[model samples]
Target: MKVCSVSVDLDPISCYYGIHGLGEPPAPLAHVVLQRALPRFAEIFQRRGIHATFFVVGSDLASDPSGRATLTDLAKSGHELGNHTHHHRYDFARLSAEEIEREVADAHQVIAQAQGSPPIGFRAPGYDMSARVLRVLESQGYQYDSSLFSSWPYYFAKAGVMGVMSLLGRRSHSVLGDPRALTAPVDPYRPGSGPFRRGQSSLVELPIAVSPFLRLPVIGNWLLVAPARVRTRLLESVRSRSFFNLELHGADLLDADQDGIPTQLISKQHDLRIPLKDKQRAFEAMLDRIAQDYRFAPLREVATDVQREGKLRAGGQNL
Candidate 1:
């Protein structure tokens, strides 16, 4: 059976500020992603009767009471929660092994408290996973890590943006991780000593969705902005993958005008200018298109099935 796992990275607005080289965001916007956008996600998913996995940053849950309430409420409604690290640091892959463990453990604790169950899955911040990061996850007994993104287009585009920012004398906090990751397998696999290679590790790596040949990212950040016809084409292209891990962010549901986001961010975050309703409509349409061919499940469930199966088919041969 074909599986499609939908997961949202609930990184707050401050992270975006750092990415755009805009230092600290206004104090009031700290919890905007959770307070304003999270409910929108819950509403849309509820309407379709879909259960998704939400990767939560531990610091958000620790600092925001209302956000914690909403997250726990979603958990009660049957959605799965995964650890997104405590700080959402874009430099997570470069941190020391001890630091990586602390980051994972801290988020694990808060998420377990909020959802009343320890998260069995994790997605690293900025889709940056290292051998050190994987070691931490294995030590904590995580079933899977869904952080390897093998889209060369996405990697190059990010590099170009960061390069421009540097030339213009703006310092973005985001890091460009090991280029070898751009060549990792696009499907789920047991990573080797390095997170990018296939091996016999216990923790599986469920990569984010990408198109076949060109490897265009089939994620929310791009799909939400693409024309309807383009979105349909991309969705059709990825239909061959047995497991489609579609990743979305809280910003996908935020509208600059309605949400009171400042112009500084709105200018850099073009998707924020697109009305929230339009993005929502496009998202629902994409889901409807995929629903015909795939069964939707949380990443944790998909990971469990993959673990039990032992071997996975990549290019007509089991790996």
Candidate 2:
């Protein structure tokens, strides 16, 4: 079965650039995401009959009254709500275990209050995670995390990093310079161990989808920017081996051209300057195509399906 899982990283506007800086107040972009982009995203998913998982930042919920209401509405609309950490911090690898626990716990509280139930899944900001972070997630009662991008669909960790390192050596403007050091893989698999493991940790890992060439993140640059024909071919190529996981940022759906976004990030990914209406049309079309070809499910359902597949492969028995 070709399973499709769509997820939105609900990070705050401050998280868009990097870590928070001193003396920066909340900006209009934050309100734009909460007020305009998110609702439209939800409506698009609903219109296409796609049930997506929204991995929300804990601080976004706690800080914005409207954001809290948006999250509640999404959960009530039958979409899954998951954690994207409180501060959208990228150095989970460096944080103490206690701090990790606090971040996850705080996010859980805010999500539970807003959605009327605690979130059972998580996705680290910038896909930055360490073994210690996983341990904290397990302790916090999270059922799964979509942060691990093992080199399954493509060799993202090895080849992708090599390319970034090469590019960075030439010039300093590479996106690779951003924190988190770009060690994530392109597909989902167990961390540090072989692909299949038993009696291991409780958290399930679901990685973002990427194309085979250069291991570019599938949803954002490749799928969103590519022409319709190219996007279709790319998704079809990856549909056979692994679950097709599409990830997006709330800002990706916003019209950067009309929205008066700061010129810095816009120039970073020039293709993003495409008109907002065009972006939405392309995104909605992609969702429609995926719905026609694959079964859309929440992360929990994907994990369950994988477990069941594993059991079936092992002499038709339950683990």
Candidate 3:
């Protein structure tokens, strides 16, 4: 069956601040994504009877009891808890090998404690994955890594944003990862020895959902903000792919007014500017539409199925 694995990256508000070159957020806002927005995602998935994957930053779980509790509950509810690194540094792919291992191991330890087992899936911070990072995952015995985003449109747009921020004297924390990643396979493949190429490593690289030709992202933030007609077109573009790795962030469900998000953040984060109700409606509509063509499963399950069937080769082609 065609698979649509919806995964949420539970990035804290601080990550966004860093991305925009804004300094640390207020103390109370530290856990806002986990405390306020997490439950909203859980409710939405629960209503739809979907068990999704949640990629978590380890420090959030270690520092906040509420975050730990929420994830523990989600794990019990059959959701897969995956590691999203410890500090969520956007420069993760550029870090030293030791630092990368520390980030992955620290997150793995804490997520295991919270979820009762080691997380089999991993997503690098800022969607930046490197050979060094891949080596760390291999050492940790990870089943899959979903951090490779191979959309040129997304990459160029990010580069443009960071460039503007730089010219404006605001150094955004986001990185313009390996340009070669823009040419990586769109489907699931076992990464070879490097970042974007197919390899013999046991780890499967599930690139984020992108259109076949234009390679535009079909992610939550874009889908929610895009005009209905455009959104439908984007969705249709990826309808034939056997795997739909729909990625979302905790901020997608956050409301600027109702969630008490500060003007500073709401002004920069486009999706946060939309009302929570509207985002919720758009997300549900997207899910319902996708359900017609694919069955929803957590990334762990999809990875496992790929492994057992031995369908994916080094070139990401199905045998």
Which candidate number maximizes lDDT?
Answer: 1
How well is each residue in 1-319 modelled by candidate 3, as lDDT tens digits? 5788999999999999999988999997899889999999999899999999999999998999988999999999899999999999989999999999999999999999999989999998878888999999999899889998888888999989988998999989888888888888888887789969887888888889999988998998999889999999999998878788999999888888876888998889888888888889988899999999888899998788677775532222462
lDDT (tens digit, per residue) of candidate 1 on 179-280: 888889988888989999999888888889999989999999899888888988999999887888899998899988888999999999889989888898
User: Candidate 3, clashing residue pairs?
Assistant: 192-199
lDDT to native, each model? 0.90, 0.67, 0.89
Candidate 2 per-residue C-alpha lDDT over 164-265 given as tens digits, one digit per residue, 9 for 90 to 100:
646665222112222232345444444433212323666556667766654555765456777888887877767654467888888777676566667666
TM-scores, all models, native as reference:
0.97, 0.80, 0.97
What is the Å distance of residue 272 in model 2 from its true position?
3.6
- State residue 166's C-alpha deviation in candidate 1, in Å: 0.3
Instruction: Compute the lDDT of residue 195 as modeled in candidate 2.
Output: 17
Better of 1 and 2 by lDDT: 1
lDDT, candidate 2, at 290: 73
